[model samples]
Target: MALTSARGWQFRQPSVLPGFGLALGVTLLWLTLIVLIPLSGLAWRSSALGWQTFWSLATDPRTLHALWISFGCAFLAALVNVVFGVMLAWVLVRYRFPGRRVIDAMVDLPFALPTAVAGIALTTLYAPNGWIGAVLAPLGIKIAFTPAGIVVALIFVGLPFVVRTVQPIMEEIDREVEEAAATLGANRFQTVSRILLPDLLPAVLTGFALALARGVGEYGSVIFIAGNLPYVSEIAPLLIVIRLEEFNYPAATAIAALMLMVSFAMLLVINLIQAWSRRRYGYGA
Candidate 1:
């Protein structure tokens, strides 16, 4: 009888606060309301533009150029942020100096500043006759009202994301680890490449993904600097807005849907990379 009872026995644990069922229901309801519903509506709207029409819109020269400018400039900006952001995080985590706190706080100024205000400020600074632009004008370097201006705007806004994401992870690393590496006859380059980089890779990638996402979706901070010229400096988001203003809802929806799909695919790839890195490092294994 005891043997039979043991065979039939089962183990159970207490549910978390408010019970699993209620928590799941709330989570699903919130997601449906906020994310799923809106995205579904967008897809539905885009579908109204038949496949041929959608294809035409997507292949339009103006549309293609705008998309390219937006994604290309964003890619460049995120790459720049990754290099500078990692350096900044290292400095903040490893060193202590006068006014370090002030500098650290200033890194988040982009987050607090309004997007439109930031756009205006950047445009003013980079315009042909503006302060810094005046100095560069003689060198024949045009910044404002160009694609380079869009890149600059993106780099400004997306920087905080990379810095904040990497900072916490960097702080968690101990200096003693580097010291131990040095004691073992490892040169600075070897220690950094082998010991430090493996640990920081995942965090850096996360920051990069965040920065890229923000840059891709950015509109307000880009328009003023980009000059929004069709097939030249126009960004995808601005194109969408222009379509909407022209009462071309189908075209707008098609562009938005395409962006949504592309953004989702890029983020999914980044997440896969993060997962693979974690597994290779034996993290959470």
Candidate 2:
């Protein structure tokens, strides 16, 4: 963009790129209509409930438990994704093996599969009588219908976000840097930690936030496997649905508002981390 002097004031010079103003206008118009409008309605409706009532509903034991399970499991799953997703991205980018393309495509199956179907399939696989669960049951392990089951479900849905986000960044990294590190007498671990990981940090953080956000709002894929025991495996999103189903609009709005605020805060933190990484490493910041 350039500035041009016009009538004692400076204005942005128009670019050859046509429709810049129109494009920006359309973008903002859609953002306001599709995103801001609904969010505004949600907040307004929640605010209609008196503060005391809203507080009571938000602080209810079941609601508290559900929120905890939702956030805690999502955080755990996101952390796991950050670790394994990076490794998977690394493998896909750096290695060539048989069935590589097939495995790469399989990573996106969750994206195409309906969440409800995913939930049922996962539940079937994790039920005590199911093959994997049957083997674990003999060892006194149980997953289905528990908090662990929620985490598992979340991990399944969230993995693709991390893998996809990090893979492109990994591919963009120059192999010459790794070779330089090796020539500098840095071992493999040192090379990865000092060079590649630093450069990938921003993308990793982005992927983690996306995964966490998705996990927080997950419902269908969790309900079947969660066993939905009031305070045990219930998620905040499910609680909101339950409230809505009972015609408790105010309560539902309040819970939805809470999740919205929390998710926003998380995204803000992720953005901050990305900025810091870019500044520190001179790549993504």
Candidate 3:
């Protein structure tokens, strides 16, 4: 007879760590305190609003518009980051140009810079009649206090995620593989498309998911550049603040709960895509 009998479950590998159950219990307790409990409270509060009231709050015109803008802008920003981030990582890893070190360091600027400060700086430069804006203003182009500005701020905040995620993967790509592709009569485009890009897809998706999450939740950097106009440039998080300021706790929590759900769904889809790619192609495919 097998040690595990006819059960589907198999014996787990012995762990070096003592007290596995204790460790698992502690992990559960930690996760509960840090994440699950707060989310549960938010859900409970939203439930207290009743389905009808919550639906009405979530479906209000301003709220709907804000939610649309937030998701739309975040998706666009993440898509842009995927392209540019891949190119940036490729360049940084493949070539040694002048100021390469400086350029590499500068990629982390958004990470180090406070979001509010970055927002103000971006607004100053992009505002109509401001430096870059002055040039664009004559051409009737505007950026600051517009939806475009939100995309720009999100791009700034989210670029590093993509770059960093994809960089290691790019660096790990073996030069010999490219050499072999060339020897097999493949051109640069074919080699990159068939070999490099497929391998990079998983990391790119993970980076996009992370950046999308950050862009969705971003508030501090966005407010200054967004103008926070109701139903025009307003974002969902800003709307939540507006509700809170007016002491509309029910509305605030309802909106918050909706945002949480939408964000979770978006991230979940991206994660599923990443997981599928990993399983289908293996890690370095």
Per-candidate Cα lDDT values, in order, are 0.92, 0.90, 0.91
In model 2, which regions exceed 4 Å deviation?
1-18
TM-scores, all models, native as reference: 0.92, 0.93, 0.94
Find the number of clashing residue pairs for candidate 1.
Answer: 0
Model 3 has an lDDT value of 0.91
Q: How well is each residue in 96-157 modelled by candidate 1, as lDDT tens digits?
A: 99999999999999999999999999999999999988999999999999999999999999
For candidate 2, the lDDT comes to 0.90
Q: Poorest 10 consecutive residues of model 2 by lDDT? A: 1-10
Looking at model 2, the pairs that clash are 278-285
The order of the candidates by lDDT, greatest first, is: 1, 3, 2
lDDT of 3 at 186: 98
Better of 1 and 2 by lDDT: 1
| Tens digit per residue, CA lDDT, model 2, 1-285 | 233443555345567888877888899999999999999998898889989998998998998889899999999999999999889888998899999999899999988899999999999999999977898899999999999999999999999999999999899889899999999999999999999898788899999999999999898899999999998888999888899899988888888888888889988988998888778877733
Rank by TM-score, highest first.
Answer: 3, 2, 1
